[model samples]
Structure formats: structure tokens, C-alpha cells
Target chain A: MSYHTLQHLTVRLLFDEKFVKFVYEDPDSALLGLDLSKEEKAQLLAIDSRAWSYDSLRRLRTMRSLVEEFKASTTLVLAETRQLAFLDKFFSSPQFHDSIQKRGSMGLAFAEYLSEKFRQKELKTPQLADVLRLESLMARCRREFQKIRVTPLPKTLKDDLRIKFVPGADVGAFQANTVLTIQKIEKYLFEVNLMPAMVLCDDAPRLMDLPAVETKKKSYLMCVPAANGVSLIDIEKSDYLVLIEARSSLTIHQAIERAMASGITKSIAQEIIARALEEQTLHLV
Target chain B: MTKFFDKIAKIPRLGVGISGEFGSANKGIEACLLQENYPELVHFFEYGGDLDRGLDEHVRRWASTGLPTTYHFLDINIEERIDLTSDWLVETIEMAKEINATWLCGDAGRWHFGRRERGHQMLMPPILCMDSVLESVDNIRQIQEQSALCCLPENPPSVVYLGEMHILEYFAEIAERADCGILLDCAHLAIFQHSRNLAPLTGFDNFPFERVIEMHIAGGVLKETNGYQYIDDDHSPEPLESTWQILKYVIERAKNLRAIVYECEHNAAEECLDNFIKLNEMFPCKIETPKLTVK
Candidate 1:
């Protein structure tokens, strides 16, 4: 076969499954106008079996699975086939972006695909962007959790009680624009109990137990790492601000001074600092 | 440490294979990246899924750890796309540049290992002229030349239905014509023999060992399919006893080796690290001094 023709067939075989079918359906026409050997032609045609078709379909299916995992961690759980349908839209869309093969890029591809679907009015959902934005932030949070450095709290330093917040503490940086409430997501570990260090959340079933509040206002998320998954905890905005201020190394006296001066009574101010240390909102440097 | 493979003079760089321990390869990568000690070069599969936020976030982890990180990306689809080549170039090679990757590694064609031999056979693009061997070579050369990053194509695992072509002959001509090095996937070679229903290429003579700049060895399960037996590398199967033996054969012959990687993502972190240490012991970073200087 001429080099270019061989190259063309070879490339098509590696990329297009449809062409593979076309070749299989009409072997003579497929082999015509080309210079493949008897062996080469037979080999290409031999791929007409179930085993070969399954392999190609498996790879394409894997691309769908990749984004499917991202979707699982980001948005509300959907039926397996439902998620697959969403992915099918992207894979079948005119814009293929990259092969949604990589974990991070698959999410972007799905998000873009979802946005396009929303634009076309193909999807009947009004919260397309909201869902994508939420899932992307959770994915980001997971990445950030990996980067967190967990240091040992030196004994003498721990006794000092001046360092309130740990080195890798952040409250308002969840990266999601939507105000996620604890009531909405008892399962949302990405926001509620967010921290990297190993945490044993005692009978304290969740975040700073703000029971009286009906909705979590723009709150702080504490991502705490456990054995298998991350725990996202919700904290009051004021309390979160206090933890941020504690980054300046507020000693027990300074902390009480700041809390009291900010209009809290002496006893409440003392309890707040004690609570921060106990919960590891503050740790020894 | 001065040592001689067939042609190499320097000690080879080393890397660990990163695969998701739980379910996601990306998750395993996140955990691997957390290691205080990581190689300057890494081989990645499915590591580029999310660029703007997901993969980018993980890439940023390498920043404070050190400077100038180089990743060897294997997740990219390498088979030529007449029109898609340019966009693929932008997505992969450009992504490599953005991440400070030194070399982009990909299989020559048919990136995955399928149950059936013909799975990868369907990707041939239709063009009218040129030799297949040289055309494939040009495809690699064009990619290597176009990208700021160095591109190395690895050999695909062989199957019986495919047209007969020796891996060594294919790599030798491509290396010579494209001026490109090979990322020799030893597992693919092992499975190639198994899948092709042929005896092993026991003798190493005439093989283009010098063209191989890097090597990949992974643990695979012993498998039987269609009356043939081979080692399967997909699905992170546990390694068989002879896996290391096969690896030793290739490492000894790859004189120009710059990196010898142990694919351990499928195994436990401790087990993978232990395997990594064991391989390092066999092929130490500091090459043993030659017994006698050549006069």
C-alpha cells in the first residue's frame, strides 16, 4: 500500500470506531483504493467480531466513567444511567474538547458540555451552572486538602495557648458561591468538617453546633480528614472571623481581650478561646 | 557512577507509577503527590482530566516542594488525527508546557490494551501516500518538533491479528528517522508475546536497545484468554513472580536508559514503596563502578 493511504487507514483505525464498522460492513470497498497486504486486509476485517467491538466501546465507556466520578464527588448523586446520559451528551456533542480521559479535565469537559446542553435547552434543569460550580469547588477542596501540611503540636508550644488557628486553617475559601447549609447536606463532608489532620469528632456529631439557626448564612467550612473521607463542618460567620483573627497569634489574654472588646462578656470570651483550642480550630505552632 | 548499558554512560533517573489506590487514578495521584519525597520526573495516566481547577490544583502542590517539575504524560491519545492533531497538540503538549513537563510520553498508536486484538486496529486514518513505517515516524517527528516539550512514543502491546512487525525494527527505524527516543514499556512486550501466541523474543540481539531512553515495568496478573496465556497490566492486578525477571532482562539491555520506572499505582503505598526500594537495590541510582577500565 502507498504510505499515505496506509497511514490514513491506520490513523482512522486508532481513532474512529465508526470507520471500523464501515470497514467491517463492506470489506472490499474499505480495502479498495488502498494498498494493504493480504494479511493487513484480513487483519483489519477480522476485527468485525464482538470481542473487538466491545474493546473500543469499553474505552469510550471509560471516558464517561471518568467524568462520572467527578460528578459523584461534586453534585447530588444521580442514577448510574442518568449520569451516563449526561456524559453521552458531551461525548456526542460537536465539541469533544479533549478526550474526557483525565480526571480533572473530564470535569471541565462535562461542565462545558452541561453548559452547552443548558444553552440548547436540551437539559430541562435550571441549576446547571450551580451544580457544575458546586462540584468543581468540592474537587478543588479535595485538592487543597491533599496539599495541607500536618505538623506535630509540640508539647510546650501546645501549653502556651497563644496560637489559636492551625497553619492550614481556612474558613471562607470553600470557593463555592452558593450558601450551602448543613440541613441541605448532612452528607456534604466537603464543606462541614474540612481539615486535613486526623480528627475525632466526638459526640459532637458535627460543626460548632449552631442549633438555633435555621439556615447556614455565608459560613466557614472546616475540612477535617478522617480515615477514608474528609469531614466538612459548618461554623458561624462571627466565630469563623474570630478564627481568622486568631491567625495573628492571639494569646489567651489577647483572645479574651479581643472577644470581650468586640462586645462579648468576660465568661463568654473565655469560653470561646477554650472552645477554639479544644476543637483544634487553634493548635500549637 | 559510571556504567554502560548497551550505549548509555550516565545513571538513569527513576520514578514511581501513580495510580488511584481506592477507585480513581486521580485520587491515587493526589495521595502520591503528598509524599515529601517525589521524583523530578513522573509518568502520569489520566492526570490531566481537570485543567483549570482539578489537575492544576494538584500541579500546584509541586511548587513549594521544589522548582522546575517535569512530568511524563501517558494519558494522551497518540494515534494521529488528521484535523484533531492540532487541537490534540494544544491540549496535551501545551498542557505539558504549562505544567513544566520535560517530556510527553505516549504509546505509538492504540493507547489502551483491549481484550480483543482488533480494538486498536480501527484507528487508521485514510491518506493516499507514503510508507506506513515512515508515515508513523513522521507523525512522531512532527509532534516532537511542534511541541516545546520532548515527545517519546512507547511501543504498543502486540496482538496476533495485527500485521507482523518486530517491535525492535519498528523502534529502530522510527528513532533514526524521527530523532526520537523510546519509552520502552516492558509489560507491553511481555503481553505482546502472550497475545501474539508466539514464543518470547528470548535473545536480545538486533533489538534497538540504544534508542530506549526510559523504561516502564509494572506488576500484572497471569491471565488466560482464547487458549493463550499472558500477563495483564490493566486493572492494577497483583504481580506474578516472573514480572521482575522480565524487567531485569530489559534493564540490562537498555544501555541508553535515563529513567527506570516501577508502575506501582495498583498496589498499596507501602507495598509499592517497598517494591520501589527493592528495584532501586537491584538497579541503584549510583551505578556500580565498572570492574575494569577499558584500555
Candidate 2:
């Protein structure tokens, strides 16, 4: 328990800027509650506040991992504002630390945090919310897929094959064409990857000019794990309904019946099922 | 005392190391393999991975070539009791079996503070105290028993250290208590010495040198910020003199040393050749290099 307390204090010193300042200014007051030995207190006090300050190597390392995990979102945010002010707020928020303690996915936590910001009108970029949501869903799907073994489909789908949604598949509706927006982001990332030296040069064009996403219409998307990576497929409203129903074990006939009851025509329902099977979004049981 | 002698003997003398997507970007392993003098210099591959991230195809392909390999985990915090999850242990054993790893090794440091999240992940050294030493011993024994592989705890690198015990004394206690071998990383030791303002070989005399089965050498940079000077373990091709000094001292003392890994997966092949040649000379491999003839 003492070791745990030491570790907790160490983590707080590295991450919580407020606590670092408090400890730096008033070590005795900050050390009042904690049950630490004299040597432990001395060791904790010996930590140089400047070494773990903002822009420290440890923070930079964390920033690198976040930027790598959410490259497109980071680039888009960077391009729009030229600064990650929201990240500063996030780092200070209790949710960030809670996510770390709970052992939850940071990508998902950030996406949820950004969602809350957008909901509160704190974030000006509307399209970024959709992008973050899609990215979060894809990351969750990939992680879930890693846990469950995917049963390989036979060479052919039988006529009476029972079908179900893949174990980690998910569907969502967004205000913007997130798939297309992500494609544009990927294109920008590709350019950045090709010109590494250009990225290092401040004077060089910071990034490819990304146009604002048109928010006139809504886009439905299905996220599923593919062989190489996570795959995003654009789906129609009817396709979404069918996949939702397919969450339960259903034969092809039952899936079509369920879709028809939801006002989808029989032919359309059959067609969606066929396409889903081909895409491996729905697997035969 | 010789519980791990057979496992130690199975490890090759001269090896190259790759950790977590290191070789995929630069093809450092491929570069080493392309060299005409590769056989004489390189003896085995040390695969460092986190079970959470899984292994990449490049590492698997190299591993499947029937070359000897050792598994180095990057995720587990050996001093934290809560980190030794059964699921993680099972996956660790599976990964080792998949790669046919000769033995397992990892830095016995707090890899993460609270839990294993990306934002929390860091290679911070444990608070060098008796409490931490006992905790690390228990974790090491658990891992060694569960995985059925000789687990060697390596010293983690850090700019700032806390506690009353020296880093050498900390690992020596763990090795003695856990009854396990140790992986002495010269670069990390040099960093600890530089940070604490001690000589590189300051504590080498008291260490359990006979328990050292593996050694690691990497390049580092002397950096200063806000008047705080420290060494950064950057894994460059140019190693520091202090690192070489520690390696020399250990080489003279660690009679059970079986493997020495040059952790230069990010450096270009030409940039690494001199160091590889130096390692080969310092700890020559038994395998013979073929002579190139003019056509």
C-alpha cells in the first residue's frame, strides 16, 4: 500500500500540473495527508519540477502516441486552429486521468471528451465530431475483434445459411459524409508521409488544404474488422436496420422478413444481405 | 544458484534487437541481413513486443526463418502486483511459444503508473526501496513459473530516479530474492550513473555479476534543459563512453553472460556496422564468417 501510494504520487506529479505546482510551492502541506516515510518524502521532494513541466519529454512522448493513434483527427484539428487548445483542457480534466486509471482506451476517451465539447458548443468544428466518433467506433471494433476469434466463411454461402452480424461490427449515422472526410484526411496524411522533411520545416506549407465537409445530408456507416485493418462501409438506412436486426441469430429468410416488416421491400432486403455477406460484415453461422 | 544455466546457455552470444514496429519502418533488420559480414556479427534476433499491440508481419517473418529469438515484453510492470493478470500471463506465454523464444526478459520497471493505458504508458523506474524490491521478486517468480521461461529483469532507463537504494542494489536484491537471472542494460545503467553523478562502474563491484545472463548496449544522447542535465536513451548508432565502460566492466565480471544485443533498430545499416563490428570484436560469435572472393 505504501508502494501504491508512492506510485500514485509519482503519476500525479508527472501528469497533474496543478498538483505539481502545489507540491512545488508547499511541499509540507501537500505531504501532510500522505503516509510516506521521511526518505520517500525526501525522494519525492527531490524531483525537479522543471523536468516534468509542460512540454517535458514524458508529455511529448504521450503526445506522440496520441497523434499517431488519431493522426487524421489531429492533423485536421492542427490545420484548422494551428494549436491543440482542446487537448490542454482534456489533459487537465478528471476524465483523462480517470480513463488512465480505469484502463480504458484513450482514443475512445478523447473522442467522448471531444463529443462533450461539441455538445456544449465549446468546439467550433462540427465535422470533427463526426470524424472522432467514426474513429472511436473503428478503434473499439478493432479491439473487440482481437478478443474473439473470427470463424472463417466457407468458399460459398449456402442458400439457407444462417447469418449474423460480425462479433464486433457497429453502425452509426453522422451529419457529414465521414467516410469521404476520412478519405481526404488519409490523402493529407499520405502527402505528409511522403514529404517528411517538409513537415519538419515550419515555413513549408503546413498541410494540404482540406476543404470543409458539407453537412447538408447525413451519412450511415458500418465499421467492422477486416483482414489487414478496420474497414468502413457506407450503408443505407435500410441496410442499417437489417444489420441491427441481424445482431440476433437469423436465417436469410428471417432477416428479409424482418426488414420487410420495417417497410423495406423484399428485393432490397435480399440485396443488402447479399452485399453484407460479400463484405464479410455479416458472417454465416 | 544455477537454476537457469541451461536456459542461459541456449541463448546466442551476438544478437540484434527490434522492439514494437521498430524494423518495419527502416528495415533495420533487413539492412543488417544484407551485409556480407552479417553472419559473423549477428547470431540471434531479440524480439521486443507488447502483447496488447501483437506482432507485425516483418517480425514474424524473421522469427519464422528458424533463427533463435528471445521475447522482451514492453507492457508489464513487474513491481506492480495488480499488473500481473492471468490473461496477460497466458498471452505472454502464447506469444513466446509462437516465436519459439529461448527465454523471456523485460525491464522490471513501472511501465505505466495506474494502469496500462496509452497515455499512462512510460518506462519509469521503480522507487528503489526494499518494498519495491520484494514486490518485483514476487512478480518475477510468478512470470517465470507461469510462462515456464527464464525471465530476466532488465534495468529501465529514466532521467529522474527516486529512493534510497542505488539502481544496482535494487536489481541485485531482486535477482537474489527471485533466484532469477538479470539482463544488464549498459545504456540504462550509464544513464542512472549520469543522473546521480556517479561513475559508470560505481556499483559494479557489489552486483551479482554471476547472475547476469544477457547484456544490452544502445546509443544515448547527453541532453540539458532548464539547467537539468541527463542522458537520453535514444538508441542511436553512436553509443556513449560511459555505456562502453559499463559493458567492459560487466564483460569482465559476468562469466555467465550468454547474449549481448545491440539495440540499434532505428539506425541505418552503415551507421550501425561499426558498433556491430565493435560488439563482434568484444564478444565474438562462434559462427565463422565466409570470405568474399572476386569474380
Off by over 4 Å in 2: A1-19, A27-41, A53-61, A64-82, A86-89, A149-167, A176-219, A234-285, B6-21, B24-41, B51-67, B81-100, B110-121, B204-206, B265-295
- What is the docking quality class of candidate 1? incorrect
Interface RMSDs of the predictions, in order, are: 10.4, 3.3
Model 1 agreement with the true structure over B35-78: per-residue lDDT tens digits: 43534233322232222222455555543333333444433334
- Kindly list the per-residue Cα lDDT of model 2 for residues B1-295, writing each as its tens digit: 2666656666555444434343443555462353335666676777787866777666677676666678899899998888998878998889888988878898998887665655667778888989999889999999888887889999999877888889999999999888899999999999999888898889866789988988999999988777777788999888899999999888888887878888887777678878888887787657544467999
List runs of model 1 lying over 4 Å from the truth. A1-36, A45-285, B1-26, B29-34, B37-54, B67-69, B74-94, B110-130, B146-149, B158-161, B222-231, B235-237, B286-295
Best by TM-score: 2
Candidate with top lDDT is 2
Best candidate (score: DockQ) = 2
Per-candidate total of colliding backbone pairs:
54, 0
How displaced is residue B236 in candidate 1, in Å? Answer: 2.1
lDDT assessment of candidate 1: 0.49
Q: After superposition, how far is residue A265 of candidate 2 from its true place, in Å?
A: 13
